[model samples]
Target: MALAAVVAVTALLVSYREVALSADGLRSQAAPAVQDVAATRLALLRADWEANWVKENLNGVPAAGESYQSQLSAADQSLSRLAERTSDDLGTINGLLDSYGTSITDGALYYHDDRPIQDQKFREAGSLLIRSDVGLVPRLDKLQNGQMDRAERLATMGALGYTGWVVAELALLVLALTLLSALWVLRDRCGRDYNPWLLSSLVLTVALAVVPLLAMTVTQRHLDNARDKLTAITTVAKQTERETKVDTTDARVRLDGAQTRVSKTSQEVRKELSAHEWQNSVYYGALGGGILVFLLPATGIGRRLNADYWRAR
Candidate 1:
């Protein structure tokens, strides 16, 4: 029993370590660096558009302003693609883009009319653009905080898993000692008789050995499957990242590939976990069944009589 306990504890510790490492690896693959860079570029493009809008629209549609707007729209599209790949924060960007578009349209209308621009309307539109850009800073900050929280939680789990391993080891050691002592006592008391007590000890030793082996095999198999899935996703992601870095490099594409890899790996790990749980159920059931089988002969009438007649009283 003590030996069995030790094996169980060791198995559990190994499993925990494997899981924590897998989780940390996944998180590292999905780092937010790509999104951060994309966001910075997007903000810069928006700022440039705003600056030009302020100057060029002061006296109605300057051709230079019109040209800058076209360039701004293209930049916005690039930013939008980045947003699509990384997050849904594009809603904020979209709002800003819409405000900028509306102001441009309004300014064009006034340009056609040759009417003096109403300062209040222009100010309101400008304010909307400013607010839109400012809104992004806060949202990005929130995203950074979220990423930090994720990283911290993962780190804590790793620490806890290591701690759990220590506790499990101690528990297992104690259990093994108890079991060995019990076996020793059984051996001495049942010295010559092939009676129920003797049989029970043999059966227990058999069960203690077999059950853990079965459980360990199943657990190892599960861990292997999880590792394979993680490997496949990583390979795909790495390939994509490499391709994206060719001549006309695009950070957004590279980031998108990395995210895909991490997401797929996480999914596979989760699936393997569910499967491992079912395997655990079967293993425990088998252990219980084996124990019951071992107890049956000891409960027989003949064995009971023999134990009563000759057993150490």
Candidate 2:
């Protein structure tokens, strides 16, 4: 009874610590990418707003004291930061924005007249800005796609934490079979009811199995939270950009809050990922292969060999 209790306690402790550390590492890895996603969406919104400003002011009539020039600038700055970590084609992104900016600026020069007039040059420039604005969204989508791929990979690795459940299950299955075999062997060879070590091993493996299932479940929940928050922020950004009459102050505040949540959750995933040791193939192979070495003797194999020795004698 004491041995079984000890085994259960030890297994629980090991499993809990392993799962917690893995979860932390995962959170840490996802943090930066989540931040980038938020930034990219924000940039897209600003660039579109810049174009909108040009459309509204096509007749040399600026939006009554509203300087709508900084959206694109903010977008450019955000993209520049994201480009450092992402393989996205920065040249294309920056080029599109530059073209839009140049078109709108050059077209405005045609509006030098004091009265409202849709000069041919102004119309052409405004059209060019619109075309560029439309094209920009697709390019931004492409960049976001690339980022999602990387995050998915990281999420998969973080999901490896769930494999602890699988491994523990396998270990339990082995223990179950081994338990049955031990019962047969003990009854035939020594008239014992059960082998204490085999019973202890069963308890230990069962305890280990339970924790990983819970660990993996928790990991999945966090992953979903992080992903949903990111999607919400991006969707909201697109909506804010598309709407012609939005409360800029309120929309901005909501987007900011959503981005903050995304950031927090991403950090949590990266932290879970950092705790895993067998991150690569070689280390995983070594850990798994090493299990067989201890497993054979720790189970009933040793007793079987001893039983054979006495029978031979």
CA lDDT, every prediction?
A: 0.47, 0.51
lDDT of 1 at 96: 59
Q: How does candidate 2 fare on TM-score?
A: 0.58
Best by lDDT: 2
TM-score against native, each model: 0.38, 0.58
lDDT of 2 by residue, 101-158 (tens): 5654454444446324424444544443344535666667666666656555544444
Tell me how candidate 1 scores on lDDT. Answer: 0.47
On a 0 to 100 scale, what is the lDDT of residue 232 in model 2? 56
In model 1, what are the clashing residue pairs, if there are any?
2-175, 2-176
lDDT of 1 by residue, 1-313 (tens): 4344445445553544455454433333323323332334343333333444444445553543554365346546645554544544667656755675566556543443444453444554555543443743344445445543443343333565556545544544454455445445545764533445434544554554455445545555555655455445434444543454363245444544454455566566666545444444544554554454334434543465566689656
All-Cα superposition RMSD per candidate: 10.7, 8.0
